[model samples]
Target chain A: MGTALNPSYFMVLSAALFAIGLYGALSRKNAIAVLISIEIMLTAVNINLVAINKFLTPEAFIGQIFAIFVITVAAAEVGLGLAIIIAIYRNRHTVDLDDFNWMKW
Target chain B: MHFDFSLLTTELSMFILGLATFVLGLVVPSRSRRGIGAFALFGLLAVLGLTVLNWDQQGVLLNGMYLVDRYAMFFKILCLSTAILVIFGSLRYVNEHLGNHFEYYSTIVFATLGMMVIASAGDFISLYLGIELMTISFIILVAFRSQDGKSLEAGIKYLLQAGLSSAVILYGFSLIYAATGTIVILEVAHATLQGQASPLLIAGMVMLVAGLGFKVSAVPFHMWSPDVYEGAPTPVTAFLAVGSKAVSFAALLRLFVAGLAGVHQQWDILVAVLAALSMIIGNLVAIPQTNIKRLLAYSSIAQAGYLLVGLVTASPAGIKAVMFYSFLYVFATVGAFTVVAVVYNKIKSDEIADYAGLVQRAPLAAAVMLICLLSMAGIPPLAGFVGKFYLFSTVVSGYLWLVYLGLIMSMISVYYYLRVVLVMFRDDPKDPAPIEMGSAANITLIITMVATIFLGIYPNPLSEVANSAAISFFLK
Candidate 1:
């Protein structure tokens, strides 16, 4: 309704959140922490989708539907990621990304 | 709005086969799990036949969410055939190295189904879901050897990187939706054509390229591939090399050519840059690798670069070239990795040096490896040479620079490929023990080797099919 709460404002917020999440995902040493940062990025995507749906195309709810799919996929990804991390932990007794140098990166 | 279920027979059958494998795996005794691989193999073969039977059928379903066309059918066949060959070639490897045969076979089926779905996806939603299905299944398969630390590490690395890339892709899709207000690809193309190019759309396009670039293992985003290939079981690496890369290219062609044709001028140069970088970097990095799997991994990256060269042209000829190359690539990769899997099962080593005197030990394996690697190196009178000819020929008029670079990089690639050949032929074996080959693996080798040579000599048939498939892409 007001310019203060417009689509551009929401877009900017989403962009900021996405950038922060990307930074955390890249810079974090812990595998689980990196997974959480990825979740943050997906959440930012959800916000962007819903905001765009409400402000730009209310007649069609494709963006909102897409956001739900993203949430579902992100949950599955985190589940698999954690399982993999645990598997590595059992073998090496560590979950630090730096310890994953068994193969040269 | 009645849908034609017949158009989906291949996909539905593949899903049911996967479920059957999983459930049967639970009921069957561990000692007899080898039957499950045979069951999976036959089931996939049946699905491959069904896909061929439905080759001419084409339709749209769910208001553009799903599509069935010759273009999609071609990729479906590729995915199914690749799955079949991988299973056939690695039956012994799976029984020996992997603990759960049922889960292994079932996940491969599901991943193949994902590739088929991605091939037929009409909109962004189906595309994203298909990609996740494939990636999640691959993550599990990559970590299937839970006792092996390297396998686990590769799995975790793939998980983190794939998760981050998918999120970036999702964000890009959201921005594109915000700008165009549609997720159906055709409608999005229409909207984009009508509207002025905005900063939102441009940013979205860039992000999309970056994310998919990771999936295809193009340079700058290819860091995860060599590690994953080296650590994952040889069979999984083979499938990842052929099936996954081909499907990603399929999705790229669909998105860039059909959905984003309106913004061709904006993204073509970006794709060209990725292609040049991947070709140069992938070939150059491959030369120094000692591990056979990692060497193929880098070679596959370079192949991805060559495939991207087709996308740069964005013409019917370009699509045809990509399809032709992808089909032949499946054979070469499966042949090469089958040799790797068989050799690893015997010697328990993937280093190129271990393959010394391989010709005296297992001549079929040695010869298949030689032909497959030479084909990938684009030697004359081989399938890879013809595929590269088509690809480079498509961009010869305008992108002469790419052609020159491709020629130089391909020559560089031959050096590494021949290095392995030299080891197999020249060096003496440390053990000098003969390796036993499985009947199934031998069959796979013969098929791939024959197909590679035959297709090179007679490229007309496959090229005709590819031409028709490419034509169908624009018929929509």
Candidate 2:
């Protein structure tokens, strides 16, 4: 192998992913789209964790273990999020975020 | 490597209870499913009793991933009681409005179990698991009334916000893990103290605070609360307000005052600012709420501000005050929500204007609402008053400005809390219909009301308990 890539490279990649995910989650008008955005953010977190485990905390694999836990939680959260979206869709026949205006400040 | 069985008895029992309730819901006949709420209540009460019995069984498990200290036990007992009351108070509402789905009770039980775990979480992994478990269950519970548009709307809103916050927290945790190379809170604190304060570490801390602040509905992160509270089922609203909010505070205490003790100087001003913003924004926004649930939601945010005062002090006395205030808040919020559930069950409206002449319609409920609202407003001779005093006094030596801001906010909060009160007593009856309440709701209201008053008068006993709980983490 020539030379190992710096951990900062992975960090930058994950941070970029996190920013994009945050943007999508904030600006998306569709509930499904929002859920997907959140998933992307979670995936960015997982990447950060795995990279840190590989480079920084290699002795314990602690970051990888956290990544695994995060993935599991993300899976569970998506399942619940989809279920809630379906529930909302059933009531209003739409999943558009703007249509969820039955409640307002 | 030895695991202490007694240290986890309350959590273990609660987990078993949640599983049993879910199974029981499946086996019971659909028509008879309503009994599951009472069954869950019974199991929760037993778990509450277990928490009290294990009050002195302080120990560590799984290499300090879980704790059974007095602090955790006190909050566990508080969570159990709040869960029990939620079940009881929502029993009739669930039966009528939500059609007695057994999943309703089972999910609440699971959520309560999650809260118990959160109360004892000694590591980041446990805290994350506990929080996700609780919020996931809440998302389902908030949409329990699937046919209602508002309920579904609330569920979706809560889901989106909860998901975003969870992602934020995970990112923050990943950063902390990068900086400290550990996920165990105690070890992380040690690492932080031993190492120079890297900019990465402080950024991670800020992210963590922002994420957790959303969980507690602190200002700037609190946009989701009023809508979610208004649209969710009333019983669930109560659970969200009291049980979930209290457990968030418990976790905050662990993370801030204990887990991050070595870096207190960096986070103290951040916490104070969050508290100040929450108090001002929550109270100010609550003034315009027309729906009772929304008003209470904003008020709950203000309460979170007051609770944050305890954390801002960064002292054991502050933690004790937080525990005591959380205790008092459970009763007051639950009492108020119980009455709201009763009223809504009869009148089918949550609007404050719909509550005109509530005194004439339901004298007991009106009185309970009065007491709860007044207590929330921090009026003297009530539990909220004493709780606020403890919190403010604890921090006054260094943070006098916070106390003054809290005092002014408390005064401002009075206008809105009493707005509901004045409508109930001073306005003419809109419907003038006699409200019929089930025995469970009546019992819940009475128990919470009495506890609110009793704790206000004799806070010494609970204060002692809180002091012991606060000492558990601080002394180490």
Candidate 3:
């Protein structure tokens, strides 16, 4: 609370966190891990937006509003997407992406 | 405040048409789908007439978010024409192959509305809304046939990519607004030029380019094109290829070319690289495709690259070239896809070998395919040739190196175009295997054929229209 991150620091940290999340999502074999990694990426974006509003753009809160919107959208996506994944799993009984080759090239 | 009801009327008719179709689709039985389509066609024609009537309004509407200039007006007309033709040609195929026919028609109307909104958008806010509307509708359309796992995959991939890019774009907008203290495009343009480039504003501009570039399927962000196109219904693929791409290009024109005229130097080099990669990768990968739709999918990626050449020039002539190329491309690309739809309707397969002996079996359809293919290959006396002519000439005027690379891709494209023609003309006809296209599809094919061959030979009026439409983008 005593030391708030500036816009530049937030942008750089957001980019770094997003990159790490992307790597984890791509390299990991666990499907649930990929979902968790995506959550990490979304949180990074949210933190960047909130920090930008707090440090730089005090007159406007559009960034924070959009951040909330993103959170809602991410939640909805995971809810529906996970249900589909479970359906695929119940039918195929596998959670690894290699087993999800029903739609590949 | 000149409130032109005419401009409002054009968009209003289209929106009403969409709503009416949605309600009718819910109430009416599936067997009566043709009646709903007829009503949809009537709606499209009404919008077309209204757009033509206000063709010369050439003024801003809705407090400047929507510009009714000839440029925006012209592209709106093009999008509607393309949508109507897509619907017309695919009626038989959609009913036979696709599961949900009524919703397809309704979403197409909605997508067309999005394109019109984009063409008329004058500010970043409107542009963002228009693009989102278009993207969302298209994602739904792409996944319309959810029984197909490929379609579901395409939808998920597109949604994820589109969502990430939209975030980048939203951040760009926030940063730009903060730096300039205005969200209006023109005001931001003025401020960007008057003051030195700030770190936040320039970063925002970069993010903006990334976002729009993703929508247009430019390089580094075009990973979704091949899968999505191959997965969707053939007619929806056509709409995505021509309709969605054209709308995004229009948005790019409004934002990068018109709004960011002050920062041309900053974006040109970056765009040059994007154009180069898209052309090289798109054409090269397309050469060995056995599937016709995927082949055209990659060809579309290459086409986007060629269109990017004109965008990179950053001159009035360059903008005109992009406009003309887009108009010309609609006939060629859409025509090519329409032919695919006919073949898909008949054979129920998208393989190139399925097209063998087409020339002998369906002479009229094969001829349309030839014209469309050669037109795309940039052969003379077809629209693609003239479109490339304008684009290359503009690139030469400013960027000599890009022209060389662009022409190389053009030559490379010949390999794929000719492969289709070669199979059609050379392969022996199979026994009891000649496919027949529906009457509606035949008619759309004929119109596209005429537009391609005739427009290329005598491109005066169309070229002038493209020039004047582009000039309006520069004006205000």
DockQ of candidate 1 compared with the true complex: 0.88
TM-score of 3: 0.90
lDDT of 2 by residue, A1-105 (tens): 798798899989999999999999999999999999999999999899999889987787777777888889888888888887887777788999998898888
Q: Is candidate 2 or candidate 3 better by TM-score?
A: 2
lDDT of 3 by residue, B230-286 (tens): 878888899999988998888888788877777778888888888899999999989
Model 1 stretches astray by more than 4 angstroms: A1-4
Which residue pairs show backbone clashes in model 2? none
Docking class of 2: high
Docking class of 1: high
Error of 3 at A34 (Å): 6.3
Q: What is the DockQ of each candidate?
A: 0.88, 0.90, 0.22
Tens digits of per-residue lDDT for model 1 on B1-476?
Answer: 69888878988998999999999999988888879998999999999999999999989998889989999999999999999999999988888899655899999999999999999999999999999999999999998899999899889989999999999988888989988988888787788778888889889989999999999999989999999999999999999999999999999999889988888889999999999999999999999999999999999999999999999979999999999999999999999999999999999999999999999999999999999999999997999999999999999998999999999999999999999999999999998889999899999999999999999999999999999999999997
Ranking by TM-score: 1, 2, 3
Least well predicted 10-residue stretch by lDDT in candidate 2 chain B:
B1-10
| Off by more than 4 A, model 2 | none
| lDDT comparison, 2 vs 3, better candidate | 2
Top TM-score hit: 1
DockQ of 2: 0.90
Give the higher-DockQ candidate: 1 or 3: 1
Residues A1-105 of candidate 3 have per-residue lDDT tens digits of 998645777778877887787677657766667766777767766776677667756787656765776677667556645654554456556767655454333
Q: What's the lDDT for residue B333 in model 2? A: 97
